[model samples]
Target: ERSGASMAQPETTRVFLNNVDSYASRHIAQVTFEACTDSVKAAALISDVEAELVSNHKRTFQVVGTVSHPSAVERPHRLDRDELLSKLMGCDVVIYNVTQHADQVEEALWAASALHSEVEHFSGPKMFILISTIMTWACSKPADPDDLELPFTDAIFWSRRAHPNFERHIDLEKRVVKMGKTVSLQLFSTYVVAAGLQYGMGEQIFHYFFKKSWLGEDGPVFGDGENIVPTIHIHDLASVVCSVIQHQPRPYYLLAVDDSNNTMEEIVKKIASVLGPGKIQKKPSEDAFLTKDLTDSLLVSLRMEAAYIKKLFSFNWVCQFGLVENIEVVVQEYRQSRGLLPVRLCVLGPPAVGKTTVSKKICEYYRLHHVTVKGTVSDTIARLVSSLLSPPNQSELSTLNRNMNPAGLEEELLLNVMRDELMTHPCKNQGYVLEDFPQTREQAKELFDGKEEDLSCVATEFVLCLEATEAFLLDRVLNLPESRVQEHNCEPENFSRRLAAYNEKQSEDDVVLNYFYEHDIIPLQFGNPNAEADCLPLMQKVIDMVGQPRNYGPSSQEVKEEERRKAGERLRREAQERAEVEQMEADEARARAARWAEWTKKLEQVRQQEEEELEATSRPMRGYLMEQVVPTLSQGLTACCRAQPQDPVDFLAEYLLKNNPFEA
Candidate 1:
């Protein structure tokens, strides 16, 4: 009868998980909300709990998440204190996590204080749970002083002490419990869950070590590396949060850690072996790249176990055996979460078949490097020549100086150079597009030979062959512009010779096609006469043949950074354009003003010259009038007045006639 009812019906439980903005809180909220839902796969760590709990009641979560830094503009996820309180009042179970951020400890205490103050006017039985960290017990004294290896468990949680740096967390935990005791008369209760160091989904505290290992660097270990750092997968930690929300166990303090007691050295070595070149370097505690809090957490020597969870909960163990034991799944999560996989490709084609063009397009679209013979040969020879300057290769330098043609070196040396280029960091990380390489079957074999069971890291995922008919190739060469013809050596005679060489069939045993066929890799043949006319369709076909990308696109953080960069570029361009226009306008106005000023000065000089000329011509006439005309007219008039007779008129006329200035 009990079994029948367990499978008979389903119910819903509204749960509130706060601080969803944090790394730990986000995982807990996601697991609690999605534990029994049909939309998402129930967390693997809580499969047993899911089977038991979903059989009776389903859970729905009201998650409150906020950004770490406050924004000037309002955001939907950034809730205020009143808004947070309102969300808290509506849910049956409220979970506030103080594990990730120190500030969250204050938030948890505030929630508890608010609950205690409002317990008298309660609506329903509300349980307030605080998710904390095992670091709080980093300095705890073991119950048995004689047994130094005694493991700390939740049964002895009362005797646990905090590290000197984590007193604030311990104080907050105590206050939360005190507040819960004050609300005993009402339907209110509190629980403090101390979780182990979390690892998974790219990680938080262990991210520095994970990234260094992934980059194939020497993983750094602090101090002697013998400290036992207890760890739990974030999924498992979330499962513990789910279990607490559902069961509401009797204990107020619960220790959440895995079964494994692996030391720091064991964990670092395991990570390096799985992802890196299996190298580790020990450094002083002060040399670690992690923040002070994380460094302290990483160097912690406390050993802890989830004794209460093991005895009371029925969840399946996801990394409950611990991180080093389940390194593969954790490493996969790390790679996929960060999008750090490479997608290598090789392109093959006859001359004038658009091999370089298509390879460049593919590299641009996929964020890959275009590796070609010309570039690789030049770079490799340059590096070899540069290396010759060192004392270790002095003999090689002398030999190279004697021979100008480094390209004439043995085939083995060239092959090694190409192999080295293929193994470069960019090719291993972002990926590479090899263009027109391995022309012969023997060359392909030498470059790509790998072990019997495993492929080399530089092996190509796909091979593309571009082909065209002889008639099409001939016509295309004829239609090429003079510059293009000269640049590619595609004149009629040269083009025909190259085409014939490309078409000549190889012996059955020595064909390059046979090499690929034997390896079960069929070359994708793409032949389109109009491919050069429009390249998008060809690119699309190639993309379809390749299928989904092996590596992920830009991450969210990268996208935001790119957006900011584009915005800055646009603003800079606009400012430059505005400045140019303003300068041009200023120059035009100055030019016009200068021209007007010059014209006005020239007009003033012309007017002054005309005035001076007029004065010089009129000055002689004025002097003659004053010196001759006035005296002559005065003598004539005096004679006429004295005569006063008929002959006087004739006398005055004779006197004036003889009185001309020049004649006198």
Candidate 2:
């Protein structure tokens, strides 16, 4: 009679096996095994047993006693024989599931013997139950007469052969049977069949096969079409174990239950069918089964049958689903658990084209990270310059001096330094955004070599070009603060001059406009303000276009036309300025010529008058003596010698040479 039960029904037995833990309890307990750790069959069995125990039988069993050899990695140590006997001395039933090592089984038997002998005062009808696997008896057929060694002595032989310690288990059973108490030993031959291949489930046959696929041309496979594989669903296995524990069966009964008794080929075929055609591979006949080599200590045939304990606790056969169905369920569950979902994106144009603003809006709408690639050559250079120049210390002087020539430093050195810094910076991983690298064609080519082969290697998702009128650029440059102007080395007064030089040096092909359309470095052209109304729709179209891979050739006619238009605009402005300057110079030359002509005429008139005066004085006084004539001649000579108004034309030419030497 069981405690806390209806006394009227004496045949109805309620066995209270408290804390009867073992390998079954640790694995086949309520908790599910991790996918990576155990076979699918093992997991299914454990899960099934746990479910039945929780739903049908409200039996709370904790691990009480587990006898394991010091090296047994499978059994728990906290529930040793001493602890088990102490807890079960007063208990009515002792349900023992002996599936571990032989030494453990021997220890349990010794503990039981001690409990029975030492505790004479306690009178309890203790029933000992032993569950064993048929694997402990099955042996492989001998090879040749010469190879007549003990069948189970070799590692390869023991792998397929039954356990050599089966006699010890049977001997223990006989001893218990002789103890004057009822003893039942259930010899079970059950096989655990995993439900399906899953991700991260502890080691399994599928993983073993997949890993083998990487080894060589062909992977390992099981041999012999005759070996029949019997599998039991984990849940059913647990149910059967629980059933045997609750209602004690007849003593010394071999319970042979096979869920599905199919050959290895049939099982492989079923797995292949679920996984799809051509999934299962056959092994070569030469080395069909793995053999052991002591010198190398290698197991030739990697495939091994499922452990014996799993085979003994098999349940009734249930309609098994193919791998596809199981995989679909697992995939769905994994996806849901990981929160992996589809993404919606809206990519803006190239650098400096309001892509950041648009990206922020898109991210806000989609609730995603708005990642922007910062650090253009210019920005990097500016930063480097800032660091070097900020304190105005010795280091700053050294850096500048290192790059500087005796005359001056070139801008290219600073740009190179900036490029190096940018290349070294970490890549942005979040969502899409603008990057300001690759400002030039050469830089782009350097940064993204073999872009024609693969675009993903490049740092940017898409390339965009921001277009603006030269006038607009000039205005922007001119209005910048003194510090900014100095930083870029741009002077407002020299704006037109520098622009002309820049345009002359810059190539139309060098510019990256509509970077997306072009395969090399896609360029996108955007108007001023880069308004969303205009740009968003274009961006959407570009996004759709970029979905497919493309091989864009050199710059198109449209790009050339746009560049030509800009060049024409610059030429027109320059032509107009040149014409105005020419007109001003012509007016100044005419005015200077008129003034010189007036001065020349006046000088000539003055000289004529002086000559007449001199003639009149030399005309020899009609009267007066020789002395007066000589004196008059002296006066005429003095008057002639006096500088008679230097020639104004010559004077003016000389004056211009001394004062305005460059004036032609």
**Local distance difference test scores for all models:** 0.74, 0.41
Could you say which candidate leads in TM-score? 1
Q: lDDT score of model 2?
A: 0.41
> Candidate 1 at 335: error in angstroms?
2.5
Question: Candidate 1 residues 1-664, lDDT tens each?
Answer: 0110111121445567655656777777778777633322232333222222333344345554455644522666557789878877776677877777787777778878887787766667677888877878988887688987889998777777888878988888888766666655127777788888899987888887887776668788888999999888998887777766555555667888898889999999998877776789998887664544245788888877777777657676678799999998898788777766777888887777778778888887887889987788677657767787687567654554455453454566556557777877567666789987776787778877832523376777778888887777777778878998898778888777777776674424576766788788788888843656788877887788776565546656779999999999999999999999999999999998999999999999999999999999999998988786878888788878987767877787788778765675
lDDT of 2 at 571: 98
Our tally of clashes for model 2 stands at 30
User: Per-prediction TM-score, please?
Assistant: 0.66, 0.32
Candidate closest to the true structure, highest lDDT: 1
